[model samples]
Target: MSAAISAERQHDLDTGAAASTHLAECLAVDFATLLQTAARLPVAAVQRMRDAASKGITQRMALAATLLREAGQGDVTHWQSHPSDTVRGWACYLIGSDAALDLPAKLQAMRPLADDPHFGVREWAWLALRADLVAAPLQALPLLLPWTEEASPYLRRFACEALRPRGVWATHITVFKQQPEHALPLLDALANDPERYVQDSVSNWLNDASKTQPTWVLDLCARWQREHSSAANAYIRTRAQRSLR
Candidate 1:
């Protein structure tokens, strides 16, 4: 199934016209039964649908995710461990948006996906859970803080990525927009992370917050440097302060 989308993407570089058309055709025939039984579409086509960013693709993926949510938690959980990481990732994506589930329950299911071997799956893990965090930043703080100390750098990065004030490919978090200080605990935890990936996320998180609170950012970075500066911390501070004019 992924092979077909890859072929379609190759055939159409500038747009996903071929991919969208092929996906629609495949959904109509080859995957109809599987979609009905599992209540989730193949991640291959879904990922393409999202990456393609076409209105047609958007509508298709939204409908599929909606169906998966309606199918019930047991069905979603079954698909969450599908052999294909793509399938599992889409499962995580669907469950992350389960409005019926409380935020704690939704995030609990998504935590494992944050450490998924596949990068895209991990990305969706954060993306799928971001809205709930944005809606209640204070609530998200305690839930997300533990990940900052987790052994996996990916999970540590997820802590920052999930709570960024101005995340990419998602809506801006209005709470952080007004009071970036709310993120200090998570930022402090990752100030000197050994992993470059984690450090980058921490820095980017601060950079995002800094956009609307230059003085606060400047003060925080200065205090961090004064209190405990290391090579990694220096790098993060430098990266975060780069755009503060």
Candidate 2:
């Protein structure tokens, strides 16, 4: 199956010409269940589905996610570990849809997704959780703090990625943009991480923060260089200073 969302597949979904084929690939047996449930939906609800056909892929996914959440049908947590990255990605999207789960529950559910074997799954985990964190930065900070000290590099990276001031493809955390110091603990933990993946994200986090607070980021990099001037730390510092330089 395709890892990336395919234009052709999205088109098929929009036109309803390949509902069976698209559903076969996306939800398979679960598609039949969705159809059965959708059939019983109110006329107004069915009309909403028809209207969403002209909307984008994300909207369609959000509608499905809402229906699944309302019906208490799909086990998104279970789908998080699916063999297909595409399925796993959608599962993550479902997790992010609206307030289906409370903040604590959402954070708990995101733990496994952050460390998923598939890189796409890991990315989706960040996309799925960002809005909640951005909405309640303080609540999220405390919950994510522990992840910094975790053994898994992926989890550690996720702590930084999800909290990035200007994260890619997700709403920015405005509070962090105003006070980047809030994420110091997470960044401090991975300042010298040997793993490139973790270091890269840490650098991006710093770079994102630098956009709002250049001097602070510069000072932090200087201090990191003063305290830990290893090659890995130097690389991180360099990347972190890219925007500033």
Candidate 3:
């Protein structure tokens, strides 16, 4: 941990706070110690987490989920409702790593986590299933389309954030890169979203595609502006074209 990490923030990271207030706190979390001390996980499970802590955050999450199952703690109900957001994040990964679940099942399992109260858990919700989405972008698209219409902006954001051709801290979705049009349904649904959170995700999704298909992004923005000149649409268009500018 950096010396710059405050004592209070370090305590939160050590004790596994419900949510991290900043990126540094989230990054500095000691998962092995957290699982053993705060989460009361088995020694074997904590050992595995310690070994995997050096890996990327995503990998650590996946390993934690698997270890939970191997330790006979697979019932994610407890973890999902845990006070610690990291534990809830582990629940998201548990759902993602379940080989028994199909894409639709996984989406259903992820719904609550995608709309989690904690921002960190919501992020883990999408990140947990990104690999599955990349493997079947076409199938994932139609399934995720309904999420854009969800009442929660978090769910609405996940619909776009999860399918970005070039998402942050995730593998690229080559299919969406090659065929950006496939994402039109989800993008169009949120073109005039009322929430800034959802709007930013929509624009970011377009910006990601803009890298691979600038012309398509330009034309789409033109059509959106022409069809619906709402302030929300204008906002999305401007941000979507930021890279091009």
Candidate 4:
């Protein structure tokens, strides 16, 4: 975003309304603009833009995909190890979004991040799980599953959370089903996740799993009843029922 545009966006956010009517009524932009906006803003501002970008991409899967193409040119050497975990992590995910980028190189960039010591970076790890590296669950299963055992609860939680069935880099259910067991350990680690976000994400995973492996979810209900309680079981059970329907 240019300084003028950033100033305008800042004003719109402050006023809580789109300022388009006065500025030629531009409704949306390409992904690059969306990311550029996200990169330029503070965290609070970026959250809204990130959500907007996620929705926009969902609605326009093929349209701004070119933005993903341009993301590969970023110099990750400076970004990959940036002190601000948020910068390095998000940059990695953006790089992952570009399907044509080198997966091996991307993996090399992420390898250090996989074991990142900062909880803040660990939290965003899931956000950075781009599909380009693991179109199939089996391929990403080993890479993703091990994080569940990390001592940091944040990393453990995100180990499963990254494979979220929708939005950002991962929007495919086919990959989740290919290796149901791949999610098993992560689920176990997250069953008692302290964070509500992580807990809700666990439900989302089951909701997704219900589509591919009802037996596994059913077994989960049976085994976890003593621990997860009737309510959590009900949530998982409802997800199962919906899957069957």
**Predicted model with the maximum lDDT:** 3
Error of 2 at 60 (Å): 4.6
For model 1, how does the per-residue alpha-carbon lDDT over 166-219 read when each residue is reduced to its tens digit?
A: 987777998787798977888898889999999899889888878888888899
lDDT sort, best first = 3, 2, 1, 4
Q: Please list the residue runs of candidate 1 whose C-alpha ends up more than 4 Å from where it truly belongs after superposition.
A: 1-53, 56-61, 70-74, 83-85
Off by over 4 Å in 2: 1-61, 70-72, 98-100
TM value for model 4: 0.53
Q: Best candidate, TM-score-wise? A: 3
Worst 10 residues of 4 by lDDT: 18-27
The sequence of per-residue lDDT tens digits that candidate 4 reaches over residues 11-82 is: 443332332322222323233334454334335433444555556333332322223334443555555565
* Two-way lDDT contest, 1 vs 2, winner: 2
Q: How do the predictions measure up, each by TM-score?
A: 0.75, 0.75, 0.95, 0.53
**Alpha carbon deviation, residue 225, candidate 2 (Å):** 0.7
lDDT assessment of candidate 4: 0.52
- Candidate 3 clashing pairs? none
Better of 1 and 4 by TM-score: 1
Worst 10 residues of 1 by lDDT: 13-22
126-223: candidate 2 lDDT, tens digit per residue? 87777788889878887888888889989988888888899886788998888988878777878888889988998898899888899999999989
